[model samples]
Target chain A: MKNLALSLLALLTLAALLLGVAGCAKEAKEEKRSESKTATETPPVKKETIILATTTSTKDTGLLDVLIPAFEKETGIKVKTVAVGTGEAIKMGERGEADVLLVHAKKTEEKFMAGGYGETRRAVMHNDFVLVGPSSDPAGVKGLKSANEAFQKIADSASNFASRNDESGTHKKEFGIWEALIIKPEGGWYIKTGSGMAATLRVANEKQAYTLTDRGTWLVQKPNLQLELMVEKDKPLSNPYSVITLNPAKFENSRVKFEAGKRFADWIVSADAQKMINDFGKDKYPEPLFTGDSTLTTSK
Target chain B: MDLIYLGFKQAFIMIFKGDRLVFEIALRSLIVSGTAVAISMIIGISLGLTIALARFPGRRVLLSLVNTGMGLPPTAVGLFVALLLARRGLFGFAELLYTKQAMIVAQTVIATPIVAGLTVAAVQNLNPKLRLQSLALGATRAQMLWTLIKEAKLPMLAAVMAGFGGVISEVGAVMMVGGNVTGDTQVLTTAVVEYVGKGNFPVAIALSLILLTLIFLVNFVLTQVQQRETSSWPKRISK
Candidate 1:
């Protein structure tokens, strides 16, 4: 009888432990779902999904979500966005995994075009990259007249700065300005953060280090962050976003979605879409997120 | 084929150079798998021992259920875990998806049943005489319990190692849960898959070779441990 009681207790205990452990696992998964906001967005309609390869800033700023549904409602074409660094996005275009590519790096996009993997590269919109840092402006670059000046001040002052280090569009621009300024960002002042725009921003915010970011994402993420835009309105800081359809000439499978991608690319540059971009974050940011200057040429 | 050879060569140089990123990935894999093994062994061993010794209604049903769980597919586990941890799932409140902890949890879930069923069989195969002898010698119930556990140690260890082998080489669960984030939650197996998918054969081969070697070493050790313990057991009457 004693043994029977002991065994029953043991069984109950084991059952309890197993149930408890399983409960924790279930709870952790549930928590992540809630935090990632998986409930609000409806699943894409079958047979109407279009894959868009693009940069992280567009998604991180909640811009694409706003744009995709409007396009979907109008065209009945659901969009599936694969947000990555510009480098990876271009690669996706080359692989024909993406029906369309919206990226900011000009030279790289040209390479994709020259390689015959991309067609009809459309200039969608333009936004300027801003050098943001602690409000104190420890590097004394807060009022710099130009991006090169700000970068020079940063390098000369040897103040801590974070680099995206991920070969992203922003990283390419930063390297460009550095090269133009004839400054080698060496020593302990430069920290490499191999992450997306939002993550790098967070890291920079936490470290109180200076970093360059698109005005759109910065405006959206500003309220929640502590950094201030230190440099802006420079010609060198101008960042333009372009959409390129995977060339059907090179990839035969890419033809099926080519028209669908063209519709989206065309929609993004339409006057209506431009107003949406222009008015985005006006209430919170009080400044336009992007300006549609499709005719503006990129620096080679 | 030429591209494959170059990729392989590059992968070798990257590994031998002790690339910090690669090491970071390997370390995360070890930590995640190690945690899974520990969690599985603890839950599985206790449950198995209890199921072996306990006389309860529906015991046969419980054993059958556990045996079924042992064969759960890793991809299915991955899908369910991804769903549960995804932003839309009920458990998304914990924000565990795409994190190392989530990967460990998924691995443990898949590995636990294996440990439990194997351990039950191990304990069930132990000689009944050891417990009887301990009782006859006037040992308390707790003392007899210890003796039984000690005698079954070899099989339990083997079961634990088997569980480790199961989790360490699993790709789908880790990939789904970890998001295969670079320098964060990536593991050897997932990295292997990623490289292979990218047509980078050398890195895939290198990572695969390492995983295969580790699994073989674990199984080899487990066999040796089981053998030593079996040989040490008394053959006469103890059965």
Candidate 2:
């Protein structure tokens, strides 16, 4: 009998948590308000759904795991999230396949907007990428101030540099550093994983190699990875995330949920959601995963 | 490995705790793969029977195509479907991209050829004289086809199991179309991918274990049905 009772309690708690994943959880306060509203002669309400295409770093840090639910509970809008490489996320937005995008490729996002794909673009958060390497520091590039110099050091040393090579934001940033140094970076020393951040980190961990990763994901996976933050706080390493809504008028006859997407875009920058973003990961990790700053850091 | 041990620990904990997330993903996996296998069985078995029992001009070409589909890479198929269902694609008006229905469509495309190609082998392996004997015994064309199918029942069951296994274990195509969008389209396979992305190998392994147990239990049941004895077990034991 005691076992049954405990199991039931566990079940009820799990059911509540499950609601967050389904993106339909509502606060108790809203239920009463909804009940009062329904007492009057009212028409049916269409619950809007939007597909938010975002990058793997933001998604893997488990930021949206909490923020999306909070946003959904407040607005009663259902959000379906898809995490891909930043390039893929931007491409999806360009094709009107995604209603809204939360991505970190600043130059690409600007190009997308100039191409008339975005109705509105707002900076949501800021973080920085760090060059992480095995504690052994095979390349002896630790504590480097400039990302370019670090890349050059690693290349000249012929150190194994694990690459994501999947066109992710991190990959592009790493490539940009190499391009700045006029290095093509094709050799046996460069290992391409063509995977997400964590997988590349694992390869780096196993091989004692070096790779670039956003701080948010790096912090979250610190306990499991053997890599150390080698070069950080570089001007070229700052990552700025933006929320861009599709030009609904451009996809007038398409499946773009303009109003709901706009709500998410406008509200994410609001005081409430910004606070949620700012406070995320502070309790678990040493510091918050991201800063809710819209100033748009001047970095690559 | 420590990772494997931790995964076992997590799986046991999640199971005993009645983790609704695990149950939700397991259930969705079953539903998506189950529906796809059933639909493919219908279409594939019919096509298999038609090609095996009749003669046609392009029958050789069709057979080769089915055989090719059985060996086709799933990720390639996923890309094809993604393009077809993209907002700017030919069927963009339906807006089925990134939905569960779209996953079913892709899996069906993946499983159909396996079912049809195997069914062709199953039918061809039977004695050609059986059809003649059924007709000689005055069985109607439909009735003869039914007998022919009944004779190939065991192998056809194998085909169904293969189709289900292929679709459920697949991650590339489902991720391509369904987008692994949390509770809506996430199945056990894609859930593992998500956890692995977080560097949570324990949880990822736990999800993979759950998926494996799911596939094992399904195959177990199908095997039971496939290998059931005609005589009562007690009678056979006495014999």
Candidate 3:
């Protein structure tokens, strides 16, 4: 009986301690929030955080690192970027967990907009996708005039092809080309690495397979990969990235934070941010990863 | 092979130079995983002691459930947490999703079961004779329970170490819950993943080396505490 009581006491102590810690955490957050609320009223406006759901390509290329801080400094909004695949990023935006989205995948973005998940989408920059393969050119796909022709030849010969089967924007584009030619690629030759662009490229390099990749990531990672550029400058391979704000009117979050979200969409397309995009990677790569040529900032 | 060599070279350089980014990430990993293990130790040890000492209904079922949870994949755990803390979930009102706190909650959920399972084994493994012996010696059941706990201290400490090791090295749960935001929620494991995804193998390997070193330091300290001579009862009982 004594042991039971003692054990009960121990359990109670544990419960109390857990509750105390949880309470303390809540109190701390509440205090910080109150402080921020107060500080925002003063001259030095405190930073408010908003989630920015963007693609891994933007982050992997080290673009957001520069852009986020600059935007924060200009607008006093701290952007917590969640760099995921375009599909997942849009999913986050759809769930209203994100304030804004920067992604590629025009088809998916259009569907998202049509579904009322986003208010607007604006083209921020453009970069072409390239098909990379072994330098030996097993399918003789090198110097192909079109992406479809190269893909058709590779499919005909059953040459190894690496697919980033994770439903990323790049992955979707690869399938788009396959569908355009009515080729349902399968078998052991079609390697599906459910990984990011850089990882898939490495797998393609090791397996000596053909894979579609954005020019920016290809240029940045080409030093380590043995895969040579197989097909380029294809009309259908032009990759355009867009920024979209969450549909606050649809979600019923008619707060001022929606304005902050719009501000980000505007700031990215502004002359200053566009200039940053144009200048990015110039010192490292022969050509910039993305081109900022859009005249319109953003629209519904 | 050459890449591995380059990775080690880079790791050593960063270690010797004490890179700010590497150390900052390591510190975050230690704090987040450490707090999680500490919380788990309390709840798990108590639950394990009760299950081991008392004859409660459905105790066997609970034990098996904990055992199953011990092997829960980090990704599955990540998904579970992502749902619970998501704005639509039960605790969504707290708005704790995609924060360090959410990472802690997921890790605690992960580490608690392992700690509890191990604690059950440790206490049960203690000679049943010791329990009866204490009760027969004019000792109250409460005193008997304390004696048993003292005897099982070593394994319990090992349990805490296991829980720490599990959470610190885990990537998926943290990535899902913490958002892997650089300089905020990003820890060593997610940093490694991000670097690898960027094809920066050397930096990734270097971060992994730092993680291993941090784990070793933590385990060494914990092992020292676990191995220290608190009592000679176990030795005497063996004889």
Candidate 4:
């Protein structure tokens, strides 16, 4: 009888522990749901928190460090920046998990806006994508004027090309170039990283292959990489970053900080923020990482 | 080589200087993985004990399933959990995706099979006569089972170690479900990956060293616990 009691106690203890964890998880989920509901109903209650989903390049290049702090100081709103690929950032926006999105994938952004995921979209900055490869220039397309021509030469020579196959902005641009050239690049020579720009750059550097990368990330990673800017000055290689505010009405269940997101969007294209973006990376490199141009704005 | 040395130095500095971010990330990693191992231990040990002692139809198939689960890839588990917890997924109503709880769930899924498989092996390794002897002593079924578990405690500790090791070192599943959100879901391994992605090799190396040291320290403690009976040299001499 005593042994039965002890065993029962042990089983109960285990059960209790499991229940405790499950209870906590359920409570947390409930708390979040309730908070989001409240946030939607009382949008003017003015929550101090704003969630910004953005591309890894912005984070890798330390642009968010400067821009976020400046915006936070100006508005007294804390920004929680989630740095991911542009594709993931846009997905977060579509899901209403983020209040704002700062991304570089124009095509994806247009689709997002057309789907009514974004309330406002404004171009904040621009940076060109450069085709980087080992100084060996195995494809021998260093002086190529067009990205498509360079890609063709790489395909013709069957030189190694590392692709960030994560549907990121740079990856999409690369895909565009390939599509324009009508080349379905698939071979052992084409390596798919399925990672961020910097990681893909490292893979390209290690493999001594060519890759498409934003000038910002490239400039930041230049000192460490063995690769050089093999192709640039292409019309199709222009990379522009835009700040998008998630439409609160479209996602009534989400705790979207519509007011704070709008403030951030306006501040990003404001004169001071534009100047800050324009001046970024001047000290360490020959040119700034991004050109702040408020002239380029896209809407649905 | 120099980078390795620099990594150690940086790790020590980060530890000693009480770097808030590093400390937070390490603490979060411990809490997340530790809780996962604990939960897996409960389920795995119970299931393993049942499988080892109980006689039932399809037991062989169940054991085979557990064995297969032992080799399940972390990324596959991560993807499964991600799909389940995604906003459009079945349990999307819970709003658990990208949260620490989601990370725990993914790690638990990855660790449970390891714990269960090792546990089954450990329990099976015990002398079958031990169960008979315990029952002969007029002990009840529950008491006999308890005695068998006590005899198998050391190997069970090994199960604990393996489970902890499996989840602590895992990066893929956690990265997918947890979203690697800085100051939130960023554990040591994911943080190492992030640093490596940014080409900050020194920081990445430092974080990797910290992870290794953490795993070593945890296993060392478990080893001490597992060998506690044999550790008493003076008691052995007196005997």
Candidate 5:
């Protein structure tokens, strides 16, 4: 009888803990809803958080660390940033899961806009992709003027190439170059890491193979890697990053903060933001990780 | 706190709505971990039995190794498997990287040691005289071993439960090896990570709750088997 009572008491304790958690969650939700409601009535009734979905390169390069805190201080809007691959970030925008998106894949961004998922799209920054490989340079792709040519050389020599097959923006760019070269990269030479740019670079470094990575991620990871830049100055390697606001009308049920998202889209291309972009990586890297969108700046 | 509540609420809704993605991820999680536990049981039980019954050289060293393996970090196991299956690694020619099979392989690696160590403990706890008695009753060596295993059935069942729990709740190895490909290699744990990374806390929470429920359900069934006719509740309540 005593044992049964003890077991029942334990069960009751577990139930109470569960209830306590649920009750706390309910209170937190109520407080947030009320805060947001009052935020519109007063200048500073409560803090507001906006979701920003962006590519990993920006975060990995430590650019967002500088930009986010600055933006928050000026606007009093807390930015909750989600750093993922550009392809996945764009998909989040399409689903209205994010308030704003900062991504590099132009084709997919256009497709997202064409689908009526985005309210506005603005060019924010630009970077370029560079081919990096082991210092040994077994493929002999150094001094190649065209990325396609470098890709072809690697294929012809059957040199190992670590491809980030995770459908990221860099992966898409790599696929485009392969398509243009008409080289069916397969067999033992072509390896898919299915990972982020940094991880793929590490895999390439480990295997002493070649891989294409964004200049931003490459520069940040350069200090740790044994690989060196082997191919650059290619027209097809230019990568442009843009910011888009998800259309609230397209996803009525989603928690899309249209006003806050639009404000962020405008703030990102402003002179202050542009200057921040230009100054980023000046001290650490030999060259800035990203160049401000000059045409957009001039028009602004 | 709200996220927790939202997670529970959303989990219930998703389950009732029969969300296709949720169902797919749940099914994949069960299949992958189930397959891994099955493989672990086969190798773990047999190896454990051998180590427990035999008086061979380095037996203590082997037992210590199994004990060390029981605590092997899942992420380390993931890295080891990743290196082995990498394109430049020895088994790279098979191209098993980033597939469900790779996830199974990693989980099996993580689970086998746990099962084996527990099985060794379970079998070792049995009376030594039982083996002699069975042998004296004209039982063959294999039959004696089988009879010994049956006597330790409860702990053997516990071994199965522990192995299943270890693999089912593991996320790092699966994420590293499976690539978390949507509609392909994605499991409940990896899906939760992906959703949380995307800032969909509600969905992440929901997936987490489902994962917890799954682990609970599997263990509940095993507990039933382990406690069969031994539960004190009925007698205590009747009194």
Candidate 6:
């Protein structure tokens, strides 16, 4: 009876191992089926999957969520977006991994274009950065016409200011403002948080300190934060986002995805999508926050 | 492909340069997994040995529950722990989420069951006659228990080693709980993920190579120790 029991247990263990192998095989078969279906359906027309590297602001702003679905519905081209910092996004494009990039760093984007890695950097949307701090405005530098002047006062007062130092588009803009104010913000009060926009804002909120944030992210986070807009409409505060497709002439693989990238880009600059961006922050906040370019609609 | 060669070259250069970031990541991974293994072994071995040696009415049910936990996914454990530790969750006041301590806790939860389950199986696999013989030799109950523990040491060591390996390779649990904060919580596996996401194939490849090497060394050392213990225990038991 003991021998029989041992034999049965051995057989059961062997059967379990076989079942595990079968499960793996089943998953592989399903993957193949999906791949073949896509290939066969687009026999005549080339169906390409484009990798779009864009900023988190675009996603946090709900711009890409609205625009990507519409673009996919209209063109039947699938766009897989990898949301990252503009620095990381540009690096992806440089590595020939991303077919197109929708980023906001003008200087960096221009360098990429000049380096021959990208082509046709088109301006897609514009939102200004704002100085947000505790509603108490501890520095008492609110209503400043110049963004630099507000920054100067904050520095002079040794008030706490959170800076995103992750080489992100927002970080770049923050540094530019600090440079224009001619102040090297290196003291204890000037917190150089090498983190994402969301995290930096969270830090600012926690410390009840000052921070510069894009209008979209700020609008989304406004309900939760005790911070208020301290400065806006300054020329230095203008944050223009752009979209650039990889230079297909250099990378042949990106050429196949060019059509998909162009379709997504076209949808971003479209009137309907622009309207959505314009009306994104109206309900709870009551401020439009961003103005869509009406000139594109008029030109069309 | 050309991409493969480029990735390989970049990985090679990064390793040769002794990149501070890569070293820091590797060190964190080791520390996290080591702490997890240490905690799990203590809890698993004590509970497993007690259950193995004891006779209780609900012992079978308790064993079944541990077996169920053995198959729990890292992500599920991570999410459960996250919910418990998140600001809105049960222990929200503790503010443990997104901290190294939280990662260690999640890993411990994941690995303890694996160690315990394996340990129970290991202890049970021992010959019943050995314990009977020890008792017949005028040994006290405590002495007999120590003999059984000594006999099962090899399997327990092997079980602990295997559990350590499982925790170290995991990314999801660590990422969710630790937040993969650069210079703070960024581990080797999560760094690989971030690099891959950024399309930085070279850094990803280099990290992966290092991960592979580390896993191989751990497995090699563990297998050797396990083999030595298993071989020597049987001889000692027979004598």
The global C-alpha lDDT for each of the candidates, from Candidate 1 onward, is 0.76, 0.83, 0.84, 0.83, 0.79, 0.75
- Per-residue accuracy of model 2 over B1-239 as CA lDDT, tens digit each: 67677777987898778787787777777767776787898999998888788999999999999999997788988899989998789888887888878999999999999999989998998878899999999999999999999878766777767787899999999999899998689988888989888877766766787788867855764555445533334763584
Provide interface RMSD per model, one decimal. 15.6, 9.1, 8.8, 8.2, 14.9, 17.7
- RMSD for all candidates, in order, please: 16.7, 6.9, 5.8, 6.6, 16.5, 18.1
Candidate 1 C-alpha lDDT tens digits along A1-300: 323333533453454356546645765686555434433454323235466778877766667767776776566565666567898788767766567888999889888888988768888888889999988788798878887888888898888899998888999999998998888898887989987776677778888899999888787667557899888888888898998876677876332377788777777777777777777656766777877765553322
Q: Candidate 5 regions off by >4 Å?
A: A1-46, A294-300, B1-239
- What is candidate 2's lDDT per residue for A173-242, written digit by digit as tens? 8888899899999889999999999889889989889999999989988888778999999899999898
Candidate 6 lDDT by residue in tens digits, B104-123: 99999999998999889888
Summing lDDT over every window of 10 consecutive residues in candidate 2 chain A, give the lowest-scoring window.
A1-10
Q: For residues B1-239, what per-residue lDDT tens digits would candidate 3 score against the true structure?
A: 77778878887898789987787677677768877888999999998898888997899999999999889888889988989887767787777777888999999999999899999999998889999999999889789989999888777766777787889999999999999998778989999999887768777887898788767855764555544534555876586
CAPRI-style grade of the A/B interface in model 3: acceptable
Q: Tell me the TM-score of candidate 2's A chain.
A: 0.84
Q: What lDDT tens digits, residue by residue, belong to model 1 across residues B192-232?
A: 75554333466677777667777886776676775666566
Candidate 4 displacement at residue A230 in angstroms: 2.3
Best by TM-score: 3
Writing each residue's lDDT as its tens digit, candidate 4 over B1-239 gives 66567766886787778777776677677778877988999999999998999999999999999999998899999999989987667887776777889999999998898889988998898768888888999999999988888877766766777787888899989988887776668889999988776666767776777789877865765566556645654773684
Error of 6 at A209 (Å): 1.4
lDDT of 3 at B60: 95
Displacement of the residue A194 alpha carbon in candidate 3, Å: 1.3
**iRMSD (Å) of candidate 5?**
14.9
Q: Which residue pairs in candidate 3 have backbone atoms (N, alpha carbon, C) closer than 3 angstroms, thus clashing? A: A3-B142
Q: Please identify which of the two predictions, 4 or 5, would achieve the higher DockQ against the true structure.
A: 4
Model 4 C-alpha lDDT per residue in residues A190-226, reported as the tens digit of each score? 9999988888898999999999999999998887788
Residue range A24-81, candidate 3, lDDT tens digits: 5865796567556546554223456788888888988888888887877666677889
- What tier of docking accuracy does candidate 1 attain? incorrect
TM-score of chain B of 2: 0.90
